[model samples]
Target: MQNPASANANVTVTVTATATVSDFAELPATASHGPLRIEYRWVNERAGDAPIAVFLHEGLGSIAMWRDWPQTLCERLGMRGLVYSRPGYGLSTPRPHAQKWPADFMTAQACDILPALLDALSIDRDERGRMWVIGHSDGGSIALLYAALHPEALAGAVAIAPHVFVEDISVESIAQTKQLYETTDLRSKLSRYHADVDSAFYGWNDIWLDPAFRQWSIAGEIASIRQPLLAVQGHDDNYGTMAQIDTIAARVPHAQLVKLDACGHSPHRDAPEALNEAIAAFVLKISAS
Candidate 1:
């Protein structure tokens, strides 16, 4: 494998025109909850038989927030891409006001919702082989859980700013964001991306702020993941420290680590060029082997 820092430093990110949303699909609730109308888009659909890259958004993120990063990365790798909005975010089904998400919400998403959505769309891993997963923040945690739970169903995983365990800084940052959401126009701004901005915001915020949630940890659970893993985080990330991906590297012996300079919690937004290059190289390296 090439040195991550050098590989990222050597590559240039080409600006590409934004891709349009392809379509939306609904998957009937396979579990106890309501049905979900997931908004998604496909990129490079003609990349026949190439491994697909599934992009998972962050806590406050949506399909629109991802913009054209997935398409850009897929085009670089000559691979297909799938980008989608989880329930209660983007154009997906909104959460009921009375419904309080459990601490295991991320687990349910990775094990249940993702599989159901993939089945609904006929992206069978058994037939098409394992696909790559690129997830950010909460979605990054979900990706780790998914890979640990279904090791055979994944080719590799790239987790950007994933949280294996909650930290004081995380809670503090979340609290600040909550305050901003309540006091500022954060809700209105988020509304442009989500069908029910409150649902999306509170669903994630409440769970993270819950006192019982401090004990939440996936460090033990992710040790079984045998796939090629790339864990990236920014040095200036306020929401989480390097310990997040560092723990992942310690657990998953073969996991590669990339610490970005002059970047923050969201490396994709702060350092898109370097992130794009790193991910493209990692994915390509794994695919070739």
Candidate 2:
């Protein structure tokens, strides 16, 4: 467990085991965007028969920011795992200074970039029996959006602290983060995980704080997600309330919810063992069915 005191500290935690595979994927340019280079790492590469677990990082997260959780979870399930950085995070292509992200940024990632990355990596949906997505925070929203958009392409999804609709709490927390970035050493700390720290931070921060974003909601759209879904949230999550996952359950009748006490926004970091157990059980049950 990460000590709360050192949660934002600049300390390196070593991974005893190495990743099975690590490489870059050069994605073709799209009509709305230019070419992108994504950085990814894989674990348990030989688990060919098992469903692949794709780990999507948070708004400010990167491949390296996931630490060893992806590896540990894949090892536990005897499954393969893929962890990658989004366009503006980690070693992937950084966003241009003048570029402003659209309000539908997360939707675009789900509908456009994710599929392209899957194709680039040659992870055929038919061959792999549909991939599983494990996403956190902003990534969790992306996962839900993806499942909604491509129900046939996913076996299941584990979304931790996903936002279907923007909340005042989320805006407040993001505002606080922005203050920390400008007044504290937060920017420098985050720089270690991102190539262009400002791009990663400001792009996400600015969009969320936009007055137009207040009305943004994926709730109606996500009702279409037919894949088995597990929505997780910490009782103490500052960015969102329990309504985040509760709304998912209300919309997707079959969706399961896990509320962890004494946990924060990051269940995988704050309550890893419990999170792992829930995910393992959820995935195994779905696979058996």
- The ten-residue window of minimal lDDT in model 2 covers 1-10
Screening candidate 1 with a backbone cut-off below 3 angstroms (N, C-alpha, C), the clashing residue pairs are: none
TM-score of 1: 0.90
> Can you list the residue pairs that collide in candidate 2?
none
User: What are the per-residue Cα lDDT tens digits for candidate 1 across 1-90?
Assistant: 000010011112111233334366667655557766676777888898777888899999988888778888888988888888888887
Those runs of model 2 whose alpha carbons end farther than 4 Å from true positions after fitting are 1-22
Residue-level lDDT tens digits of model 2 in 214-245? 99999999999999999999999999999999
True lDDT of residue 102, candidate 1: 92
Instruction: Provide the RMSD of all predictions against the true structure, rounded to 1 decimal.
Output: 8.3, 7.0
Residue 168 in model 1: lDDT: 97
The estimated TM-scores of all candidates read 0.90, 0.91
The lDDT values for all models are 0.82, 0.85
